[model samples]
Target: MSDLYGRHKAVLPDWLALYYADPIEITHGEGRHVWDADGKRYLDFFGGILTTMTAHALPEITKAVSEQAGRIIHSSTLYLNRPMVEMAERIAELSGIPDARVFFTTSGTEANDTALLLATSYRRSNQILAMRNSYHGRSFSTVGITGNKGWSPTSLSPLQTLYVHGGVRTRGPYAELSDDEFIAACVDDLEDLLGHVRPPAALIAEPIQGVGGFTSPPDGLYAAFRRVLQERGILWIADEVQTGWGRTGEHFWGWQAHAENGPPDILTFAKGIGNGMSIGGVVARAEIMNCLDSNSISTFGGTQITMAAGLANLTYLLEHDLQGNARRVGGLLIERLRAVAAQLPGVREVRGRGLMIGIELVKPGTDTADPETAAAVLEAAREEGLLLGKGGGHNTSALRIAPPLSLTVAEAEEGAAILERALRSRVQ
Candidate 1:
């Protein structure tokens, strides 16, 4: 039989590329580092697109997955699974959504799709109000709501579903608008859309826009939007795929970062929930979830193994109190990044909360355009053995620094040091 590396090189398809994969094959990972096939170790600040909450190869999750694999791995949703039930209850309890009903899926996109379906079903409306530059998922219906034109280029066509945009300014959509003006403008836009479009089923937002350069909406944004939606009898769906599972710090839900607003009607979580175990779920009030009468179901939504992994990941998170660590470490990292921004010439802004941070880079003269400087910094960091992700539509110029919750102060400092060096070297 061919060796692992040889088999991968020989058999892997080319069209499967989503993000650019490193030419070097990664063999293993632990904590905040991953090793390539040739045994070169690299610091992982991107956290596998914010999925590795507990870092790679966490022992508890591995053991749970192994134990379940040894016992029963593929129980259909038609049959009751102990781990599945336990995980659902635990997630609902931790989320603080009373009597929350959950439907599990293997990916964030699937969870968002389920949430959209549920919202449409509950409100009996086809229209959806989504924030500009927001990213929900890649599935057909989910992509319909995603505001990033780069991700959903075809969405603008007449064949696509109708979606109204709220606040989309990048460098500052409403920078000129006063706090109250901004709020009024957003509400006015939504009201006009609702008037013309009639009734939108839901208003989907990413409390802090992840792919849109980690742009945090103005304070009280969600509360204000929720009020409007409530008046219109629309459900509120917070797409916490990138911001949930304690990555945002201080709170388990990203919407909490907005303000002390009431809970959303539906919350979709995926990235950090399983700590890289490929599990996603939608938690909604039992009444909202009960809208579907056996007509909506996914064949592999809640598999036995995925639930076991999720349960184990949650157990590890709770036992170790990693949420507190994310808060402390993430604060340190953000402060340090802000300090770096003060010295860096090309940095436009440093924004975001907890581990999900973004550093926007622009040309020295241009106020809004993203230049090659950001890409250069990323490449330099990679050469220094630090991995990062890119965001900001059409620009790909924001440095995405979403490390795992298991990231330590030392790891964060080390990564920040590399970033600082890279930025200084390029911009200076």
Candidate 2:
């Protein structure tokens, strides 16, 4: 381990995971590339788990943050922050929730936590329905609802959580089923589950299970589930931490893929809106948002600096049509990756929408997940100056590829070549 790595281990919790056998210190980043402390530049595919929505060190965002900082950096929610109000207005309109209200938090975890609080308070139920192989957050309430065992550390939770199926469409019992049949089975399962438990406050899910190796059900599965939820008055909370802000290319929001029955009752978003500034929020109809009787405010949630950064970042994203860029580039990248995966025996599947793709590695000629091979490939990719992320259900068996919305065709081609070399280097 490097001296810095040793110092990090000494100070930080062991549970806080670090990537690579030899961890790297990214000293700086620009565009799609980051340079390590030793000055080795790697094309950053993960983008800090998709937190850097636009390009790194974006001048617009930096200027906004700096100007805001110069004016006023931290003002608690008690004050009328213009930047926060303006950003919230834009987000409310873009949220797709009619009569929507937005409440900011510091991170996706806190945003989801607030969503859970609101749902339970509004519905007067602590029961929550979460998808199997799902990841919500690291908080007590979120961990309780998280279906992925690898991340969920404790069973003791404030809410009654039930795990449902259909997140992974490739290896589950329903994997063999057709898309229609899979949706039917999952909906049926959800109905059966509701029958057995008290009415759940909400069914919270990521349209694309980000930490679950970017796994997703058929496009309309959540739409089917939404139909069931509507009848039962169960709120649907789309956890769009990783899938929000047009990262998926085809849709502005991940829930749009399942928008037949209208948008989710509550939507939680973080990671990208601030473009590296800490910005997260929950949006819902005014009715649900106002359900909380007592007053509450996230102290540092919508500070002027972060909100300013968010406003600038969001403006740039919309004006530059990064979503459209994602569609064009992400489409080509996925096709390129699939072509590469086809030649590798260990590659089980190459799937996901737009830039949010995943490559699942498995033992050659067997169904067994090969997390070691996945780890090896990650290291190899790093050696080839390409940085990627690893995630999956329980075992880290899939490589996650989610670059910024500004990823170019040339950069995508370069990343794909490096990834192909990394995959090919693995001994099946």
Candidate 3:
């Protein structure tokens, strides 16, 4: 191992996951690519878990952060910050929640934490509902709501969390049903769970379960459940950390796929808004957001530099209509990958919307997850000068592809070809 790798292993937690056996230190990046410490160029398809929103080292984002840093970097939330207010205004308008109130945080975990605080306080209930095979964040509170066994490390939590079904469409009891039937069954399950437990403060879900290998229920599944939750005054918290800001191609927000009822009551977002800068936030109507009796402030939540980065990133994303680009390019990429998956027996499913996609790895003949080969594929792809990400329910066997929203059709084709080679070489 390299000296840096040795130091990392020595200092970092043992559970901190690294992609390849030999991790490459990324030195610099521009556009859709990044260069490792040894001066090797690679197509960064994962985009730092989809945080590098528009592109890596985009000039606009760089200029904004630089300009803001030169002026004022740190002004605590106690003081007024112009950039923070401006960015929050933009987000509130885009968030689709009526009379929305925006509160920024440093990461998705904090945003969800704040959301949970608001929900429980507003509803006067400590009981919470979370979708099965879903991942929200890593904090103590967020972990309690995370239903994925691989990600949730502890069962101890301050609040009582109940796991609900219908997050994954392919490998569950509802897998055999049609889309409409699947929605109905999931709604029935949610109703049954509600009847058994004390009324939950909220039902937290990701429109597309990100760390669960990009799996999602059929479209409109959440809408069906919304009606049931509405009657009981249980808030619907849409964890848009990975699925927000038009990454999903067809819709600006993943929840738009299920817009039959309306937008979610509370929405938590992060991981893409400020590109590489740390920025996460929660949006809710004025009433729910004002429910907190105690004063709450995020120390580094909406720093001027980060807000500048966010404003710049959002501007570039909207002005250039990168959302449209995601739709056109991601559609072609998924189709190409589906064709490739058809030829590979180890491939189980090619799924996702927009730039967010997942290729599930399985034993060639059996339906069992093949994490060993999946790791081999990740190693092979890195060796081929392409970086990818791995995620799934308990197995961690799915290849995640989420290039920047600005990914071109040519880049998509190139990444797909590299992925095809990686899969073929790894799977028997």
Candidate 4:
């Protein structure tokens, strides 16, 4: 290990994972690429887990953050901050919840934590329904709701959590069922679970299971669950930390795919909105947001600097029609990857919507998850100057590919070619 790597290990928790066997210290980034401390350029396919939305070091975000820093970087939530108000207004409008109120936090974990607090308080219940193979956050409360064993470090939690099925369409027991049948089975399971337990405050789900390797159930599955939740006065919380802001391409919000019944009762978002600025928040109707009896404030949340970055980032994303770009470019990228997967014996599935995609790896001629091959592919890709991400609830055997929405056709093609070579090497 390099001296820096040794130092990192010494200071950082071992549980805080780093990518690649030999981790590269990223020195700078721009557009869809980053350079390591040793000045090796790499095509960044994962965008720091979808946190860098538009592009790396985009001038708009840099200028916004810099200008705001010159004036005032932080002012507690006690004061009226213009950038905060503006960003919240835009987010509230885009949120689709009636009378929506937005509360900013520093990260998605805190955002979901806030959402859970609101749901439980609003409904006067601490029970929650979470999808199996789902990952909400790292906090004590969120870990309880997380269904992925690898991510959920503890069973003890303040809320009562029941794991539901239907996150992964291919690997679950209901895999053989058709879409309609699958939805029906999951809905039935949800109903059965609900009948036995005290009414849950909300059903929290990722529109696309991010850390669960970008898995998703059939469209309208959540819509079906929404109907049942509505009957029981239980809220629906859409964890859009990785799928929000048109990253999924076809929809502005991941919840929109399951919007037949209506938008989610509560929506939590982080990661991409600030384009690498630390920003996260929860949006809900006024009544639910106002349910808290005591005054609560996020001291470092919605500070002037981050709010400015968020505003600039969001504006650039919309004005450039990056969502449509994600659709057009991401579609071509996935098709290219599907073709590449077809040639590799280890590739089990290449599935995703738009830029948010996952390529599952498995032992050839067998159904067993192949996390070793997955790691090999990651290292191989890095050697070829490409960066990718790995995730899976079962065994961390899926390679995640979520580049910046601003990724160009040429960049996408370049990254795909490198990844194809890596996967081929593993199979050989």
Candidate 5:
């Protein structure tokens, strides 16, 4: 038990396969760096899949959790709690949704499930529409809406969810369709799908597709889709699980990046909202949320400890202006990565804004990049004391870089250096 890896190997459940162990067991983390069991440190560029926005063990969040634990940790959602009310008020004020109401959960998947249920209840429709390459969650309903076929296998009855290609695939970041073309295709697809099935209860989408290879659709895509949904009287649900909480640079919420389009009727978030704490919430307009009165309620949705952590995390994000920092540092990293990509052979494109960036790697003979090369780069980076994540579909290959908002310029430069070395060694 003295050896970290041995201790874990002995006690870890056999049913769970390690996602990415790297032969290094993480013992502690601070800011943007984590120490392995062997006392080796690595710069964390993935940031817990964009979960630790404020950084590891943030002082303010720790204090709030500590204080709340000393008092009360759990309370049935049957009664309103002060921390829950305060967190809801903060969310409503910041979002500028005057009639905003919040429903709390412990994970992004649960929050999305709640949103889907709410959408179905309000619109009273069975069919749901989602974009291609989207990853909502692992739950049956959310997984059904997820566009990735690999994650969800073909079944006899797959929850009756409808799928459509968001836009035409282009030779750029996210498949691009001309604004007009995308709009026309979306409307036609929705019409065709609705003709076969009932009208959709809701149209769910991510402002920027995180698991969908960090794809960002062209400007006016959202606006055009909103118009179509409005014409059909369908609700719009924005899933900001990975892109919200100011991680996308300038905006506090990912949907804000498309404010010119129109705000979503229901917005869901998790990840950075608690700055690493386990908390997710759904923010809905009063009209949509009020429909919940006819449905069954849960007791542990909004516990006191989770609410406290969320409140403190939100306060810290606002007071310190971490959103601005994300924009600034993200710009710096994108520029650096772009420069490196220009010098590399297999590099295809560098996409994303703020801290949510992706490097698409293209192979020579293949139409798309080689996924193995992307894996090599990630492994090389880990060997060099840096960590990164990967994404994209079967023929696609990309390296996802989403570090903590607290990442410094020097650390960013160092990460770029390591990445350059890795790509250089692999390409030749």
Candidate 6:
């Protein structure tokens, strides 16, 4: 394995990061547990960066993919693709956008990029609005809208992006305000920013900032902001790459938590829907989606096999009521983790919804982020046969926990116990 790791480093890009000091090669997974190449079993907490939404190796999705592959694998969008239409129809019905149109992509980056393109084309402006400490994707255009300094590698972009406040409720200047007050302040800021610039095409945001350590503003913040944007005819784009597909437990989509102004003009989703297959997409009103004058297609998007797998995965989760399972199981898990966090001084905050949770660590008796301690806890968790993930705008100082939506109560308790032990190792 070490030899393979050495070879991986030699061949892979230097920027592609791996978890743990000595990364474990995951050989296989079932339910909420995965086994490494060394045959050590571990509870999976991060869900492959919140992508393996359903349990790993779900038989229904596997069977669907197999059957589809046996019949046909790939057909360019120039030809009719039944599975793609079926998947899109289901998504459009569930999207809540009136007269919705769905466009498939190969990854979240492409989905978001498509959203940007449609917004810019429809509104005829190159300006955009984003949230502070938010991450959209790694593509050049998506990265331009990313406000996280750690993730945005370049300042150059085709679009003029203006970042807004109120994404994080705990650390910013308006952190001390009440919920209503926070929303007001953010809206005022947005209005003020607009006064100084050209009319922007749209405002893009995540209901819960994923790479920003699962932090989010008070509910209705976006609703409040949307009111201001709508007056100016700016579209709202909800980036649900990590927060979609009932991963948050409380709602089918994270945007529902702030549906006061109704659904966003455009919604981008990826991760989890295909349950490990490559599937990403954008949903919007027909007007916005059809704004483009020229035709465009994603070569690898909506392949027959992937669409079949996605359709089966979506059906299985809905039929099995996995969202309800996420709600019940995630509620208990968060309460358990909160109880544990209360005793640990290094733990600053434990925040999230459903299976998507984040534990922000800070130096004891200080407000500064403690990335070293967070990294140490991650290593300790791995040693104890538990896999975890790290994220945060503050040098990756938060521990992200997003297990499969089907995680059992027993698995949650076990993972919590191991994590408690790992966290306590800091002071012991």
Specify the highest-lDDT model's number. 4
TM-score of each: 0.92, 0.99, 0.99, 0.99, 0.91, 0.99
**Runs with alpha carbons beyond 4 Å of true place in candidate 5:** 1-21, 153-158, 167-197, 293-295
lDDT of 5 by residue, 104-198 (tens): 88888999998998898899876788877788887778888887665555443335677765622444333466656765666676677767876
Q: Give the TM-score of candidate 4.
A: 0.99
Task: Evaluate all candidate structures by whole-model CA lDDT and list the values in order.
Answer: 0.79, 0.93, 0.93, 0.94, 0.79, 0.92
The superposed Cα distance between candidate 4 and the true structure at residue 35, in angstroms, equals 0.2
lDDT of 1 by residue, 309-378 (tens): 8888888887888888988999999999999898866787788777888888877756664647777787
lDDT, model 5: 0.79
> Against the hidden true structure, what lDDT does model 3 obtain?
0.93
Question: Between 3 and 5, whose lDDT is larger?
Answer: 3
Per-residue lDDT over 70-145 for candidate 6, one digit per residue giving the tens place of the 0 to 100 score: 9999997879999999999999999888999999998999999999999999999999999999999999999999
lDDT of 2 by residue, 175-239 (tens): 89999999999889989988888888999999999999999999999999989999989999999
Estimate candidate 1's RMSD in Å.
3.0
* Per-residue error (Å), model 3, residue 136: 0.6
For candidate 5, give the lDDT of residue 125.
76
lDDT of 3 by residue, 82-163 (tens): 9999998999999999999999999999999999999999999999999999999999999999988999899999989988
Q: Which pairs in model 3 have colliding backbones?
A: none
Q: List the residue pairs that clash in candidate 1.
A: 169-173
